[model samples]
Target chain A: DAGITQSPRHKVTETGTPVTLRCHQTENHRYMYWYRQDPGHGLRLIHYSYGVKDTDKGEVSDGYSVSRSKTEDFLLTLESATSSQTSVYFCAISGSGDGLGFGYTFGSGTRLTVV
Target chain B: AQSVAQPEDQVNVAEGNPLTVKCTYSVSGNPYLFWYVQYPNRGLQFLLKYITGDNLVKGSYGFEAEFNKSQTSFHLKKPSALVSDSALYFCAVREKDTGRRALTFGSGTRLQVQP
Candidate 1:
């Protein structure tokens, strides 16, 4: 968990504004992920990256997008913020290819509020 | 589709009493199960994981989970509960053969330890 860091620890923006949350890692893990934590949703995957410049959508990827230009950096962007998008965003990394399982180490999380 | 289910939305147990939080999964082939805990205003912390060679996996903070292959369940348990043990718990799963390493998390179960 210490190796992962998420930027914008707390943010408040008006609806329709664009916002981006950054996740940086020092572990050089090949698999990086972005998840949103909501009341009943637990942690839903918004997007994930398998490698540099290779990303895919998750179950709740409608209003979100991700980019992984480097192995250590994974960014999640909201094209236009909405009230429904206000939730705590978490970034996770997996090094299973390095010989562990699918268990991930998560960043502290970024709390976003849209008014 | 691979998914995890945490039947109880909230579980309350008295201090010093045994506690259990139920979780079940549906996935193809052998599954990798994981448990995570989230304290207030923080990201998730890895508790334990069930990869192989162990039906009962012990994790941090005196928490343990029983992996029942036949029942498709991995319920978290603690012999004696503490007030500080109250937190939001999550169960996640990923198929071993899936290329994507991101886990699918359940709705989550809140454990409330009463004094």
Candidate 2:
């Protein structure tokens, strides 16, 4: 096991409301990433953090923001949730920046529904 | 930009028969390939990866993938299909020395093993 945990395995909220998803890892991985899985799109990167307080946006990052305050915690927030933002959010951690002897470990994922 | 492609949206096979899920990728430089499996309502589980080695790579749950550099394909295969192997499979790729560490995932292919 990679010691990764994601909170709120399922959630439902009204449109325009804000929602936050948390990803915690027991392993001290240097890189943390947030991805959303949608039908026909596989998993698209939303945001990722290479280190504490350092982050970058991804292809589908328009409706989301992310923060990493500690080595173990990465937080993903949707400022105003929309029906289109309803997706299964996953967290993945890697030991290195590149794929040099490193592979990603994914979390259980948070299923968000915007009603 | 690097990208992965899964040509088939679904693959059906009978139990005890061999199975294959095709994946192709486009990236500059040598590619780092990976495969993941996802059951319903679950997070993605790492299957196997090929960085630089012999063509065949074996992973958990009796899964193996062959990396064909010339064809730019990494196809997942199993000697015998199991009903339990029915799940969504994803292929991902990251190019070496691309300055981007994130993986580009292909659209998933659903695998159904009928008894």
Best by DockQ: 1
Report the alpha-carbon TM-score of model 2 versus the true structure.
0.96
Location of the lowest summed lDDT over 10 successive residues in candidate 2 chain B: B95-104
DockQ of the two-chain complex in candidate 1: 0.80
RMSD of each: 1.3, 1.8
Q: Identify the runs in model 1 with alpha carbons over 4 angstroms from their true place.
A: A97-100
Q: Score the docking of each candidate (DockQ).
A: 0.80, 0.65
What does candidate 1's lDDT look like per residue over A1-115, in tens digits? 5889999899999999989999999998988999999998889999999999999999999988889998999999999999999999999998856334668999999999999
> For model 1, how big is the iRMS in angstroms?
1.2
- Residue-level lDDT of model 2, residues B1-93, one tens digit each, is 899999999999999999999999999789989999999878888889998879999988999999998999999999999999999999999
What are the per-residue Cα lDDT tens digits for candidate 2 across A1-115? 3589999899999999999999999888988999999999999999999999999998999989998999999999999999999999999998854343566899999999999
**TM-score top scorer:** 1
Per-residue lDDT of candidate 1, residues B34-113 (tens digit):
99999998889889999999799999999999999999999999999999999999999999887868899999999999
**CAPRI verdict (incorrect, acceptable, medium, high) for model 2:** medium
Model 1 scores a TM of 0.97
